[model samples]
Target chain A: MRLGAALRSELSKLFRQRGTYAGFVVVLALVGLLTWGSHYHQDRFKVANELGPDFVVAGKSITALFIARAAMDVAMVILMPVLVAIVVGGLVAGERQSGTLRTLLTRPVRRSTVLLSKLVAGCIYAVAVTLFLGLSSLALGYLVFGWGDLVLFRGGLAILGPQAGLLRLAEGYGLAAAAMCAVGVLALMLSVLFDNPLTAAGLTIAVLLVSGMIEFMPYFEQIRPYLFTTNLPMYRACLKASVDTASISISALYLLGYVSAMVLVALWVFSRRDVTC
Target chain B: MSASSVIETEGLTKHFGHIRAVDGLDLSVHAGAIFVHAGAIFGFLGPNGAGKSTTIRMLTGLLRPTGGEARVLGRPIRDRLRVGRSIGALVDEPAFYPYLTARQNLRLLASLSGGARAEEIQEALKLVGLDQDADRKLHTFSHGMRQRLGIAQALVPRPRLLILDEPASGLDPEGLAEVRDLLRRLSEEGMTIFLSSHLLGEVEQLCTDVGVISHGKLIAQGAVGGLLAGGGPAVRLRVDDARKALSVLADLPNVMAAATGDGSIEVGGERDSAQLNELLVRAGVRVYELRPAHRTLESFYLETMRAGKSNDRPDAEKAENDNDGSG
Candidate 1:
């Protein structure tokens, strides 16, 4: 009965968050315009500096492409957790705060079923949102910018093979999604632990923010390698000269550890909680 | 206990540190009977700390009793999940997602309960008289309507037993009447109803049997008419002439006292109405009313509350139990 009809109950609540829709629209507009403008700048410089009288430009036109690519990469990382905090944080706390938990628990379902169902729904939303970002980038990069060759970083600049690049993009998305999923679960668990949604969301975001700072510290780098927040950006490593999967794998394991712990705690608390509100 | 009994609780004791919300209590609710608990209405009742809510929560598998046992349909309280399919309870104020329409809320509850169909949700809505306003968001419902919707949601699955906590608290007079009729209809169809309330008059009218719990203990329990029939208080005998009936009863042997009211004589102690009636007729006094004149559950519950004593009955425990769900 946990995941029973209440799963849809949570789902409907998620869709009701006006911020989610707003976030989607904002992401699309910014990413689309950024990619197109980058694409425009790339072609204009090529036609002017190379095809123009001087004929100075060579193979790839270097006009704002790096900035656009970097912006896209950063946007991808920021999109997942930033846009999803409210949904994830509200999972249990929102219901508890609003007294819906009593309504939900009165039904005949296991507590774990309810938590798992909500986790699965959050995963679905995360996948969809991340994919939206990735696809929009691909659209701008190919259709508008013209898919001749993609510039790169790491050791030295070199163009990427689309087949290989696309795979790397997907892998990065997966790693990032898994990391965000853990964050979402952490927020949900906190939601269960706390009675206020604002408290849960605030604490969750604060944890990620503080951990990110510690991971960047000179001495904490080693410990940082174990943090899920640190590994969130590891997806970019897929495009680096020497791909080191060691950190990504470590991050995945750590994310899994946090997710399980949070889920277990949530069930333990909810099962015994009295409907006091 | 007869086969007509549906819910029986024995020595249902629950303690929280120094406070006992519910203490040594024994209760039996007969099948096809609407039983009410009224001691809880005027002031705090149940164990000082182990409240009756704790008891209901344990029965619903939401909490574990400190010391006690309860049975429904002869099934002991355990983790078997049998009650999930049969029991519907509103232990206290019920909550629902404010954004969801009443119909959506019921449908979802049905699906979660494992066997509730969409049609059953509709039936439940109709049963609670909520069909006309089923589509409204729960936030917009008045307190009374919210209470009705809560009832509708619980009944959606059509469980064998329905536990309502103050189900009519928020209803207006008309709404209360509707609920009274609805409960009667349900019980007529053989559904067991256990409702808790503070309205003695209403409970006395709606419930066939009544149980009084004070300080977490069931002080008195029985059929409405039976409990009212016996007493340790004044009895008023209405007859053609109060003076004649008083004189006939005054002549009875070992008579302690007698007082006359309009067309009646109030008697106390040594002689009962039957003995008093025999003396009246011998004295040539025409007697019409010889029944106990002032027996009511309302006054009975008040007496129990004033006494502060409770029942210490214990129920049989579940032989085997297994509750292994997420929460």
Candidate 2:
């Protein structure tokens, strides 16, 4: 019941802040542009398929289906972090700065419940915002680019039949949204650790960037599976019909551990913390 | 008094790192009475850094005491939510969300509290005199308005024990009078108000009892009447036949002093002046004037505060002249 109240309060807080809604609009616009560009640069009327159809691309019949499908998957992967940060960065630190939290805690509510509410709300925001971008992009893509064979992108492509392309898009976006939820949780943890929003965002982004860089270094081939960020874009790899699920699943488990540990720390620290200061 | 205790603490101490904010302190607040702790209005009243605020924080479950037992509603004060539900405290300045209007802020608070109703919120706002300004953003309201709003917010929860630490900090004369009246009304309705202020006069008027803390230790605690009327309100009894009357009046326990008043005898500090006059007449002495006399509460306060301060002075250097004390 307490957690339910906190969740309700968090929802009101998320929508009440002008900055949050404004950022949501900007995120939709940016993702919409990316989604539109995937089809705008090329003529979707010209179709090329190895099995049946062919199109002239530089006088050679090329499979542009694979390229457009790759673009959609890439857009989902890239938009997840920045959009997720908007939800994650204000979970705790912003409350501390704003002083409304003092009145909240003075009530008969526990600190753990407050943080728990924030985490659940962060999850909601993450999933909702990511999916909103995905659906907007997909609708815009179809409206402008028209439907084509959805090519699954990893290395070699599996051409999803036109009838199954929308379903494929939904499944791909689901995986992307799930990845962003983990990112949101991670960012929420960072928000709890620091008082300044900008610092929390910088630190979370830095962790992601450093982990991504270290995982890509050729010398550390054995460490890629262990790096959380390496698994971060692993959802994009899910577009392939056949791929190793073991590493991506393991990364998800590791991400869960990191998120749980950070949230627990936030709860523990906040529980006994003297909010008077 | 034992059954009436609402809050009790025995040597409750809290140390933040190496600094002792609240030292070994013992206090008990009786239910249905206004209890005030004086020594911190202009900030120099309480024990210097003894953690009076810390003690209030611990009592409100904002901070866990490092040592000693502190009980509110007869239970330990660790579980903040349970303890918080029973207590409403304005430990320091009222912090509010600047962007929100006073009413909106109260609405959010009421939602967070035990329960919220339109009538309760409006009632609380009216009690604190913030109803007229309820629609104004908190930033536009003056400090006194915010202080009253804080009182309203603290009272909105309808806590069993209202713990207001410096609730009157920013108020002017009219505002202070309003707070005093509100507290008087609340106490009359059986709400135990434990308020702290540096204004001795204000506490003297509002509180039925009081406690003084210095350097994290409670130096004094007693009923305001006892502290004021401790000498039992010196009474003068004039009667003819000085010899027998002085002896007879001295024999009575309540009379602290007996002397001849002109040709008549004088009996002072007789708790029951009427009874003493009756006794003198029954003793076959013609009684003339029989009336109680003493300094006012203000004079008594100044004297007691002076005595309490010089309490540590050498015995020979101390003076106990009732007349000279206030002087």
Candidate 3:
């Protein structure tokens, strides 16, 4: 019951601050821009194909699901983590900086309860941003390009009917939300460790960026499976006609493990930490 | 722990890295009448860096003590949630989300402390004289207003024990008086207040019990009157011949120390003023006025610090012994 109150309080404070919604606005704008760019490129492709290569016309149909998938790809790789990092990074560290955590901790609430509430709030924010990005992309995509069968060229050309494509997109969005939550949890752990919000957010993003870069290297293939960033792309697997269930499950498990480990560490450190500020 | 005691500590120590912020300090605050009053108002008296704030933090569970244990309202300090619910605190300064209004900030804190109703929040604001300004964002609040808001937040839970650290540090004269009256009123209403401040005059006016700390060690703890009336009851005699009065007072068996000053002789020791007056009358010294001189907490604090400086071990021990003897 106390945790619920704390969560409500945290969410209220989170939403009241303008910085909290800034990330959402940025994500929505990015999605809108991406959709428009895709539509414009698709129009250019139609003109090019009509004037020249018949082969280009075979793989050129821009379906709503395809636009969503493309937008999700961009979001997962860059904007989504950034959005999650900004909010989660400020969860604890920002409060510490403002001296509000001192006031909060002085209440008749356990340290663990406060930390858990923050973690839950960060997860909620992560899910919200991810879902917003996914839904906005889908809405904008359908508005511009119209719904149709999704064609993919992964390994070989595969075409999925509209209904199957829509289901895959939904599954992909769900998996992407989970991945973003893990990223948010990781950022929260960093937030608990640092008193500076910017440092926490910057370090979280930097770690993600560096880990992602290293995960793709041929030499790091052996350790790639162990890296949390490697599983971020696992959401893409949900887009396939014959989904790699084992790989997707393993990726989900990895994200779960990462989230659990980060939360545990964060809880331990935060509960023991002195509120010097 | 005694039933009347609300806060007790046994060698409670907190060391930040190598710096001993709070040394082996033992303190007990009884939860009964202070002097003639029905409630206790303990003034945690100390100079800056004297570990007053550190002690408050530990008692409030903001800082973990390195050694020893403390109990508040019969529960161990480590039981933070339980202890916290019973105690309302304002540590350092008032801090809130800048964009949030006074009412919003209080409401947020109130919810954390088992959910305070809107009327309760309004009442707290009214008590702090912030009811009119409750809708103003905290960023627009002056330092004094923020301090009042801090007090209001502490009062929101209607805690049994209010632990404040320099609560009136940044307040104006009117704000200070308001706080003083608020705390005094709260104490009278049966709230146990334990506030730390270097503002000796404010503490002197508001507190019934005082604990003097220096260099992380509690030099003295007892009733404010006892601590201020150091050594014994003091009498200041205004006489025609100060030297003669001093000489007369020196011969008195009960008189401890007598020194002649500007038109008066300050006498220290346990002795009746009437008896001394009679002695002066018989000894041929014309006594114009004879009044009991109460030593202020400031003088007592300074004397304690001076004594500690002269002989660190014996003075601290003496202060503690004095406290015990008086308490």
DockQ of 3: 0.65
TM-scores of chain A in all candidate models: 0.81, 0.83, 0.91
lDDT of 1 by residue, A1-277 (tens): 4464556766776777675577678667877777666656666534334234654435653323333344447775555576666667777788777777766766777767877777777766666676676676666556555554445555534455556555656776676666667777877778778888888888888888888889778988678667767666666676564467886677667777777877888878876665555
Identify the CAPRI category of the predicted complex in candidate 1: acceptable
Residue-level lDDT tens digits of model 3 in B1-327: 454568888788987665667778888544322212236888887766678888898998889999987888878999888898888999998898889999999999988889888999999999999999999999999999999999999998799999999999889899999999999999989998998887888999999988877767877778887776667766778888777776776676645444432445666657888888888889998889988777666656665665555455664445444444654
Taking all chains together, the TM-score of candidate 3 against the true structure is 0.85
DockQ per candidate, 2 decimals: 0.36, 0.29, 0.65
Candidate ranking under TM-score, highest first, comes to 3, 1, 2
Of the pair 1 and 2, which is ahead by DockQ?
1
Cα lDDT of candidate 3 equals: 0.82
Better candidate by lDDT, 1 or 2: 2
How far does residue B217 in candidate 1 sit from its true spot (Å)? Answer: 2.8
Question: lDDT values of the candidates?
Answer: 0.65, 0.66, 0.82
**Per-residue lDDT for A91-181 in model 3, tens only?**
9999999899999999988888898999888988888888888788778888887888876555445678889888888888889888888
Better of 1 and 3 by DockQ: 3
- Model 2's interface RMSD: 2.1
Q: Tell me the lDDT of model 1 at A114.
A: 73
DockQ of model 2 vs. true complex = 0.29
lDDT of 2 by residue, B65-131 (tens): 8899777665677756777777776767787766677877777776666566878888999999888
Query: Among these predicted structures, which one has the highest lDDT?
Result: 3
Residue B191, model 1: lDDT of 76
TM-score of chain B of each: 0.70, 0.68, 0.77
